[model samples]
Target: MLKRFFPDLYVDSIYHIPYETLKKNQIKGLVFDIDNTLVPFDVATGDQRLVTHFKELTRLGFQICLVSNNSEERVTIFNQDLQVEAIHKAQKPLRRSFKKAMKLLKTNPKTTAIIGDQVFTDVWGGNRIGMTTVLVRPVVDRDEWITKIKRGLEKKILKVYLKNSNNQ
Candidate 1:
C-alpha cells in the first residue's frame, strides 16, 4: 500500500513537470486532482498558470480530466472555470473514478498518467489502476485534519521511496 502511494516521478511542484517528458513516456492522457494539486483547497477558481498549462496539454494532444473527492458544488465550480471534465466525490484509492476518467479520455491505462499531491489518494489509486503517477508537492501545506494525518504516514513511505529511487 505504501509503495503504491509513492509515484514513479516525484517533483517539487507540478509546474516543473515538462510536457516533453509525458510525450517521451507515451502518455496520451492525464487525470489530475483538483484541490491542493492544481490550486489551494480554499481557491474557487484556477490560476492563470494552470489555465495555460491546460491549454498546452491539449495542444500537445493529451486529453485531460479532473478528479476530486470534493463535493459536486466544489468540483462543478472548478469545471466551469477550467472548462474540463471532472468527477465529483471521487472516493480515491478506489478505481471507479479513475476508470470513469479513462473512459472519458478514451485512452488506455498504459497511455495515461495521474498527477496529484496526495500519496494515499491520488498516487495509490492511479498506481492500482496501472497508470503512471506523478506526485507533486501540494500548493498549500495546510490540509484537512484527516489529510494531514495521512500525509504524516505518507512522509515515512516517501523517504523509503526516495532511497530506493536513488539506489536504482
Candidate 2:
C-alpha cells in the first residue's frame, strides 16, 4: 500500500529535525543519504554548515552513517572531512545496505532512523526494516535524470499522503 512509502516524519530540511526529541524517543543512530539529502547532487563535499550539524548530532549522542547509491569516490570525497562511517553504492530500498548500516552503528532497527530525500529509496527501505524514517525535501529543485523520473511518481504519492495527513 501507499503506507510503505510513507515516512514516519517529514520535514523541510535536516536542519529542521528535532534531535533532542529523537533522542528522547530512544533513536540512537541515524543512517543518512548523502547526495540530495545533505547536499545538492552536484555538490562534491559537505559544507561547513553540514559538518557542524553532524558534530552537533554526535554531541547529542547519536551514531551517524552516510549511505548513498553514488559511487565510492563520490561518497569518499564527501566524507573526507566528516570522517564518519559510510556506505557507498548502497543500492537502497534494499534491506542489505540498511542492515549493514545498522550493523556499523551497532544499533537495531528500533533504535535507528534513516533520513533521506527520496520516498522509494529511503523511506520505503527504512520502513521495511522497522527503522524510523524521516523524509526531507531535496536540498535543491534540481535532480539527476533517474531521480527526476522518480520524483514525478513521488509527487503523486506525497500529494495523497499530505492530504490524508491533513484530514487526520
Candidate 3:
C-alpha cells in the first residue's frame, strides 16, 4: 500500500529537519542514509557544513547511525572521520537492519527516526518498525543506475502522495 512509502515528514533536505521539534517530541536517535541523504554519492566525504551539523547533533545528545546499502568499502571510507555507528549493505526495507540500527543506538522504535532520500527503503522500513520516517530530496541528480531507476518510480509515487495530501 502507498502508506508504506508515506513519510511522517518530508523536507527539502536533512538540513530542513527541525531538530528542536524532534527533540521536543522525544526523538533520541537518528538513523541516516549515507549517499544522497547527507552527501551526494560522488562526494568522497561529508562537507564542512555537514560535519558541523552532525557535530551539533551529537552535542545535543542524539545518537546517530549510518545505515547504508552501499558496500563496506564505500561506507568505511566515507565514515572514517564521522565515527558514528554504521552498518553497510543494510538490505533495507527489511526489519533486520532496522533492529540492528536501534541496538547500535541503544534506542527503541518510539525514540528513533530514519532520515533518507528514498521512500521504498528508508520510509517503508522505518514505518514498518513504527519509527518516524523523514524523507528528503536527493542531493544530486547522478547516482548508481539502480537508484536512478528507483527515482523514476518514486517520482510517480510522490506525485500521487502530494495530490492526496492536498486533497486531505
Candidate 4:
C-alpha cells in the first residue's frame, strides 16, 4: 500500500539524476512532466542547465517525451524550443497519455520510467502502467489552486509514510 502511494524512486533534482542509474534500472525511455518539474510553472522555457541535461540523456540513448496536462499552446512552445515530442492536455493519472507517449517513443513499459514533481499525476500514472516512477521536488512551489490542494494532501500522506518508515 505504501509502495502504491509513494514513488518508486526519488531524486533531489532532475539535473542531479545520473544516466547510469536509468541504465541500471533498464529504463530505455522517459516521460517527463514539464512545468514545475523540469522548469518552474511560470517559466516559459527550460534553463540552459535543463537543456544540457536533455542533451546528455539523448546522447545516452534514452528516448524522451514530454507528457503534460498544460494546453497545446504551452506545450507547443516547449516542444518547439526544446525540439522534443510532447503531448499536451495529457490528463495524467489516466494512463491514456502515458500510453500515447510510449507509442511515440516505441518503447515498452518495462523499459520506461516517468519522472515528475507531482506524485498524484506522474507517479500514479506511471505506477498504474507498471513503469518505474521518479519524484523530484518541484522547481517552484507556486501552482494552480487544484494542484496546491492536492499537494497539501500529498504532503500529509508523505509525512505519515515517513513517520511509519522511521518507526519500523
Best by TM-score: 2
Q: Which stretch of 10 consecutive residues in model 2 shows the poorest summed lDDT?
A: 16-25
Instruction: Score every model by TM-score.
Output: 0.96, 0.98, 0.96, 0.93
The better candidate by lDDT, 2 or 3, is 2
By lDDT, is 1 or 3 better?
3
Q: Model 3 over residues 18-68: C-alpha lDDT tens digits?
A: 988899989999999998998998787898888888899999989999999
**Local accuracy of candidate 4 as per-residue lDDT tens digits, 1-168:** 756667766677897676698889789998999989988887888877778888989999999999999999999987775787799999999989999999999988899989999888998889899888888889887997889889987887678766776696
Candidate 2's TM-score: 0.98
Q: Residue 89: error of model 1 in Å?
A: 0.4
Task: Name the runs in model 1 displaced over 4 angstroms.
Answer: none
lDDT of 1 by residue, 117-151 (tens): 99989999999999999999999987978898898
The true-versus-predicted C-alpha distance at residue 107 of model 3, in Å, is 0.8
> What value of lDDT does candidate 3 attain over all alpha carbons?
0.91
TM-score-sorted candidate list, best first: 2, 3, 1, 4
- Candidate 2 lDDT over residue span 1-168, tens digit each: 899999988999999998888899999999999979999999999789999999989998999999999999999999998999999989999999999999999999999999999999999999999999999999999999999899989999999889988999
Runs with alpha carbons beyond 4 Å of true place in candidate 3: none
lDDT of each: 0.89, 0.94, 0.91, 0.86
TM-score of 4: 0.93
